[model samples]
Target: MTNYKINMGRGFKATTLLLVMSACILLSGCAGKAQTGTQGNAPAPGKGSAATNQNNTGGQPEQQKKAVSETEGLPSGVKVQKVLKDISLKNNYHKKVELLTDGGKRITITDPNGGLVLLNLEYEGTILEVSGRKVTVQLDHGGQQTMTIPDNMTIEDDDNLGLNKGVEIEWTVDADGNIQNVELDD
Candidate 1:
């Protein structure tokens, strides 16, 4: 008659959960820092203005900062020249960068991706397979790339590899995705 017993489901221990939460909180402050360029000299606190007269402890009035024009080094009253546009990079697939030139004039720059430009690229991977002038390479970061070799694309197989070989390839491709040069590193 005393065979009846109680059964309860298992639950997480509070001590273990607390440790994980504490670790996450402590590690959250280890994020990368931002990159800031050179900073200008800041005026001391309590200074009214650059032209305000303030006596130092040595009894000398503070010097006022001189105002210089943007074209200080150039001829007087001459307009300063600046870039009108940038095409080294692209903000989007079809977006062209706009820049301000001299006299506050705006100019537009065409993206290099939209036109033909010579680009040299290098990749180190294992040659998984090779078919005629086409080669498939397996990258070190778990990926593969198939390269098409054109008649004008130079190929220098220093490694003398056929298949399944660690190879480094240097190639140049045009903006139209056409291979123009290929060099295999030893």
Candidate 2:
């Protein structure tokens, strides 16, 4: 009977020790302390010092704005103060037709019809050719080209002002300085 009691005591002690050790470990993990390998969340190497300065000053960081393309001039009566990206098109009911981008901003333009149009603007816009439903534009980079108005798609000008939903168009100067072949939608 003595031996049995001794064994029970040993088991109880072991269980108690385990529970205490577990609690200590959990409590240690919750303690707050600066971690190694980083200095108070400082900016890493290669990032400009401007970011850190802005954070330290508690002021908003200055954003670098993109310049407007010379080729993509504003229309005669319509002034385009800023070029936007990520334009969207949807039906009158607000159903999403597509997402447009000037390569960055998401623009959404609703059409009178139940169709949505999304425009993705490039850095520099150049009208190369509008063959059938395919409209190709010259990219800013030399020899590179971007095409809009995918094949097997029907495009109708809602405003009849040259810009059509789901169609890509660009203005070009001709010998007579007149806008020609402006509509390219496939």
Candidate 3:
């Protein structure tokens, strides 16, 4: 094996030059990608890394369906992979789905239709209050959100499938955070 050494003894001028060069290279690459993807160039992402591989695969759904199946406890026939939770909606209830890639860095999906891959997420929360089919959960983002409970459900402790305060609930949800299926965690 060969030994490599980074010169930590470099002066401020060298460091500054290195930083400027890096900035230029990154900016140039970003400009190229932005030009290809956008009309006016407001700095949106170009082709996504995760979906481009599966979505553009000769117009096939088998590989996409297979990938969506890996997500645990998703609803049948629901092709979304993750659903973001929020206290309110943007663009009139239009929500965003995020996927973890590139060493756990999250990339916001630029594609509206990600083929069979989607953002059907499962949220884990503590039940703050419950009444009928309505439930309020203390979300992972440090706020409470109210959602409607699905009819066909299984509750771990409550055989009646009725939600109660202080219980932990894991729910399969859509991009809007609406509960599609739910079960008790404890």
TM-scores, one per candidate: 0.31, 0.22, 0.36
- Give one digit per residue, the lDDT tens place, for model 2 in 1-186: 011011223444576588668845643443222224356564443242476455545221111111222222322332233443322221111211111222212222323221222222223344465454444565433333344443332323333323223334443322232332233323
Candidates arranged by TM-score, highest first: 3, 1, 2
Clashes of 1: 0
Going through the candidates in the order shown, the clash numbers are 0, 23, 8
TM-score of 2: 0.22
Q: List the residue pairs that clash in candidate 1.
A: none
The better candidate by TM-score, 1 or 2, is: 1
Question: What C-alpha lDDT do the candidate models reach, one value each?
Answer: 0.37, 0.33, 0.45
Candidate 3 backbone overlaps, count: 8
Inter-residue clash pairs, candidate 3: 80-118, 80-120, 81-118, 81-120, 82-119, 82-120, 82-121, 83-121
What lDDT, from 0 to 1, does candidate 1 have?
A: 0.37
Q: How big is the positional error of residue 186 in model 3, measured in Å on the Cα after superposition?
A: 1.9
